[model samples]
Target: MPNAVEPPSASPTRLEEAYALLADASGAPWRPLAGGTDLMVQMTGGIGEPPERVLDIWAVNELRGIGVDADAIVIGALTTYTELRRSPVVAEFVPALVEAAATIGAAQIQNRGTLGGNVVNASPAGDTLPVLLALGAEMVLGSAHGERTVHADDFWPSYRTTARRDDELLVRVRIPLALGRQVRFRKIGTRRAQAISKVVMAIAWHSSADDGPWADVRLALGSVAATTVRARTTEAAIEGKRPTRQTADAAVEALTAELEPIDDVRSTADYRRLVAGRVLHRLIRDEGGW
Candidate 1:
C-alpha cells in the first residue's frame, strides 16, 4: 500500500496571534500567507515544495490601511495594488507609485497582490520596487520582540531575497513626502500589457531652479541587476548638471558602464542595457524641454 500523504497544516490567526506564533522558537516554522498571489502560482506550477505549516494572515486587519503622518505616508503591508492605484493620498504625493501599481497584472491580480508580498518576494522585475527605491521608502518590520524599521535601500541585498527575518513580518511602509520633486516611472516589457518587465526605471529629483542643476536626485532601475538597484553612478553624472543633451549623454554612458544585466528569457543583456540608457536619455531630455 502507498504511504498516506500528510496534509499541510494551516492556521488562521489575528495580528497578535500571528506575532505570538512567530515568537515561539521551538515549533516548525510557519510560512506567512497574505494574498498568496505569487506563492499560489509557484506552488501550483511545482516550482517548490509546499509549506508544511501555513500561517494565514489575511484576516489580520491591523495590516490593512493607508494613513498619513506629518513626515511620511504610511501604507500597510497588506494594502493591495488596486487600493494603491485608487488611493488619493498616493495620487497626490507619490503618483509614480500609482503608475507602477497599475502596471502589475490585471485588475484581478492587482486586487489580490499585496505590497508586502511584492517587496518580500524581492523579484528584480517587480514594478513597484524601483519606485520605492527612488522614493526612499522605509519598511516597518514587526515581531513579538518589537518593531524595527529598515530603509528600502537596505531591504533587498540580493536577487529574490530580502532582509526580513523569519520571525518578523513586514507591517507597513513609510514613504517620505517629497512635495515639490519631479518624479517619473517607466516600464518596458515584451508586450504592451500584463507582461513581466524587461527594464523598469524610476527617477525623482528637485530642480534648483526652472532649468538648472538638479538636486536630491534618486534614480533606480529594475531587471538590470541582481536586485533592483539605485543608479548612483548615473545619478552622480546628472547631479549639479543642467538637464541637457550633454548631461543625458553622460548619464547614458555612466548607466551603460554600471548595469550588468543577464541574458534571460525575457531580454538580452545588450538590449536591456541599451533600453535603460535610452530611457534615461529620454527622461533627461523631456525634463529639459529639449
Candidate 2:
C-alpha cells in the first residue's frame, strides 16, 4: 500500500462556491467529499484508485441543516446520522428514520457518516434507503445550471448506481409528511450494534384516524434485492385492511414473492427472504394495529 499522504483537494465554505468549482472544473475528474466515512476507507484500499482531486464540501453551511415546510421536511445532504438521531424535527416527522440511523455503525461513525454519503454511495444494504423510500422522499440535485428533483424510488435503478449526474451534487432530501401517516423501521443484523444488516425493512401507512382502516401504505426493503426496493405486491395486499394476523400473513406471502435475495458475506438468501416476511408481519402487528 502507498504511504498515507493527503490528496489534492479544495474546501468550499458555501454551496454556490462548491457548485461553481464543480462547474468550472467540469469533466476534469474530481470526486465530491462529504463525510468521508466510506471514501476514506476506500482510500485505504477498499476498491479502485483514489481520486486525484477531491472537492470538500463538508463545511458548506448550506448543506448542513434541517428545515420544514407545511408539507415536507427538508434534510440537508450533509446531515449526519447523529444529527438525525438528535433532531426533534426528525423525532416528530419521521421517527422511523431515527430508528434506522441508530442502527448504523457506532458513535464515531454516526458522527461522521452523512445521510448524503449514504445515499450517494448507494449501498444495497444502506440502512437509511429503505426508510427514505418508504417515506416517499425526493432527492434534490444541484448543478451550476439549476436544481432538479427526482423521486427516491426512481433514484436507484441498479446496485450501487443512481441517476446522479457527474456534474451534479445531491443537495438535500425532502420527506413528505401527511396527516395520520406513521412509519416503522427495523434492521435485522447479525448483532445489534456495529453490524451490517442482513435484512432491513421500513413501512409507512396513512389512515383517517389511529384506529381507522388503512387508506394507503408503502413498503420498502434493503439487502434483499439489487437495490433497495418496494414491496409493491405486499403493499397492495394490505392497503385497505386493518392490521390483522390473517392480513399480515397474506402480506408476508406477498412480500416474499416480491423480494429477490442472494447470498452474500453478511447473510444467505433464504434467511433474508424468510426474515423479511416475519419482520413485516411483526411491524404490522405491533405498529399497524390501527
Candidate 3:
C-alpha cells in the first residue's frame, strides 16, 4: 500500500521540472501545489472548479527553507507556518510574523499550510497579511522567463485576486530589517484558535523610548475591505506624536475614515469599525504607555 504520508501520485520533485510541466499545453493548465491546506479544502468542499493538472511542488527542495540576506530575512514560499513559528531567524528578525504564524488554524493546519499559499490565497482575513503589510514585505515570484518582485501592498489588487500570473510561482517573501521597532498584532475571531479571523491588525513603529517620539510607523488591518489595507491616514495622524489620549483619539478617528468594512456573517460593519477603533486605541495606549 502507498504511504498515506507521501504526496499525491506523479508529482514533480524539481522546480524547473514543475515549471516545464506547467508550461506544457498538453495539460492545458497546471496549478502548483505545495501544502494544499487551502486548495485541497476548497476542492473537497466544491467551492470552485478543480484544476486540470497539478504540479506538486512539495518535493521541490529549493522552495522549502528560511534564510537571511544582508538587510532582510527571506522565507521560502513553501515554508510552513509550523516552520516559521520555530525558526530562529523569524524569531529574532520578525517576531510579528512568528506571532501571526502561531495563530493560524491549529497544529495540523500550521504544519500543512505554506506561507506562500496564505499570501496567494488572498483572503482578506488571512492572519499573516496584515503583519506582512506592516513589515513592508515583498514577494519574489519566479517563472521560466525570470523572477520578479512585488511589494506586499501591491500584490493583492482585488478581492480574492493577485497580480501573479498563472505561469509565475511565488518563490519567497523578503522582509527588510528595522531595529528598535515595536510590533503589535491582534486577531479577533470567533474562537482563540482554529477560527478564521474577523479582524486582524498589525502595527509596527520605531520609537526611541516607550512614550516618546515615534517614527517609521506602519499600520495594516485585514478583514476590513477587499484586501488587507494599510491605515496610512491613521498612521500619518499619530506619527511622531508623544503618547497621549488626544493622539489616541485622533488615530481612532483617522482609522474610522480610512476603512471601508462590510457586514458579513462573522461580524457587522458597525461592530468591526467600533472594535477596530478600540483595538487601535488600546494598542497605542498600551504600547505608548499613555
Question: Which segments of candidate 3 are over 4 A away from where they belong?
Answer: 1-10
Give the poorly placed runs of model 1, Cα more than 4 Å off.
1-13
Candidate number that wins on lDDT, 2 or 3:
2
Per-residue alpha-carbon lDDT of model 3 for 263-290, expressed as tens digits?
A: 9999998889989999999988886565
Off by over 4 Å in 2: 1-6, 25-27, 288-290
What's the distance in Å from true for residue 126, model 2?
0.7
lDDT of 2 by residue, 58-135 (tens): 999798899898889999999999999999999998999999999999999999999999999998899999999999
Give the 10-residue window scoring lowest on summed lDDT in candidate 3.
Answer: 1-10
TM-score, predicted candidate 1 vs. hidden true structure: 0.95
Q: What lDDT would each prediction earn against the true structure?
A: 0.89, 0.89, 0.87
The predictions' CA RMSDs to the true structure, in order, are 2.5, 1.8, 3.6
* C-alpha lDDT (0 to 100) for residue 258 of candidate 2: 80
